[model samples]
Target: MHYVTSKTLLSSNNGMNLYRGCTHGCIYCDSRSECYNMNHDFEDIEVKQNSAELLKKELLKRPKSMVGTGSMTDPYIPIEKNLKYVRKSLEMIYRYGFGFTCITKSDLVLRDLDLLEKINERSKAVVQMTLTTADDDLCSILEPNVCVTSRRVEVLKTLSEAGIPTVVWLCPILPYINDSHENINGILDFCIESGVHGIICFGMGLTLREGNREYFYKKLDENFPGLREKYVEKFGDSYTVSSPNNRELMKIFKKRTDEKGILNDNDEIFRYLHNFPQDSVQTKLI
Candidate 1:
């Protein structure tokens, strides 16, 4: 909800965050980790006033690469409906002949379908959506501030029908909450039906750190009631906090994705994302 001028945009690897912090209110958000120092409140949403101009300048100077966003914050948050920074950035990427990709939980991405399709037709554009649980009720609890799982699946289907490739982040499966065979199967089924090109799952468990860990535990106490004590007894200041069902859940994940020909490997997906197609006609203009 605040604006500040940004000196630069785009990282060495061609990523940019148009906004710092987030309003998504996802209970397991890692961006809140103390490792990433944010001077503002998590929900305040610091807008980079000069992001569009800065991105245009950087795009002109850099080699054609896949430009990405929504790493630290969801670019399609509610504020995006009015700010429209993400849409502006997409236009610049398309105009510059750069491939585009982003990680988001909002269905509002559909609003920029025209630009995304144009960029994909010229080069490449991948829409990466996160689907943690198939149950809409659980999704509401875990990612309270964004769209539900079924609606996101619909967005994926719409994008696929438009001939745009899509990817899904199936991650941070909380133990004793969503780490069930039924829950995992439901989510995987949704991915397969949506025609997602890949699923990035680190494991069946979520990670906890200083800032995020405290916030997650607080929410657990409020919602799950005494789940915090169980986490302490089980993890007790550990970083990874992997699920006991990780092995079995991963078995199911790999088998399903492999059968469906959807990628289950993180490195493979990363390569797919970072590899910018050089066939773009716009590349010649630049």
Candidate 2:
């Protein structure tokens, strides 16, 4: 890990990434795509040493609080063990009473449960987990080296029981791999059973780009030989890799989410994510 002084920490939308590049090694990671243009290796994490301090400054100046992270890269990367930057940032957010949200695949987030609960008590805290496959074996192949789907479900359940809302990203359902009807239904079942507030699934598919595509194909050749050629023949340098059963799987996804009353539309879920609720006392006065 290397430290760099960031000029600014939060984005216009109030998102912040304390670290760049990930070590979790998800085979289909989009952050590794050339479009992102990281100067360092993907595993050689770049830490924003000033992130927490800058976040404190920014939150102090803001009129309202709605800060989020873990969009471009997972905030709770393995390197966080030595850094503890994410934990410190969460402490700042809780101290300032800012609503917090993050997307991560690691159960390491449980370590900061105290700060998360505090933020949820004062404002709101949303935890979004990405679940691509229900099968542990397939999950190992697809998102190798991260926490398995079952453990992530446990995290979601634990967060839900704490009254901290949760969202699930059921995405990148690799074509011909984990795109079966049973796989989608199994994950959706877990979400509904765990009482997830919403699910963000953009159809049933994955997208491959310059850097990520090469990496994914290399993994395919190593693990699932002959699959790379099939992908090339089917997609042929295309960005989107929709499953052949996309329509059918989406039908099940929409119907099940609709039945459970979980927020299914991406825009609506995003709105829920960004919309900070006014304090109950303020609402009563108004």
Best-performing candidate as measured by TM-score: 1
Give the alpha-carbon lDDT of every model: 0.91, 0.88
Candidate 1, 41-129: lDDT as tens digits:
99998999999889988888988889998578988989999989999888788877899999999989999999999999999999999
The CA lDDT at 95 in model 1 is 78
- Model 1 TM-score, 2 decimals: 0.98
Could you tell me the lDDT of residue 57 within candidate 2?
84
**Model 1 Cα shift for residue 210 (angstroms):** 0.7
**Model 1 misplaced stretches (Cα beyond 4 Å):** 283-286
lDDT of 1 at 103: 93
Worst 10 residues of 2 by lDDT: 277-286
lDDT per residue (tens digit) for residues 1-286 in model 2: 7889999999989989899988887889898999988999988889898887798788888856678995889988888877888889888877766788999999998988888998888788899999998898988887777899999999999999988899999988998889998999999999998999999998888888999999999999998999999999989999998899999999999999999899999999999898887881111110
Candidate 2 to truth, TM: 0.96
TM-score to true structure, per model: 0.98, 0.96
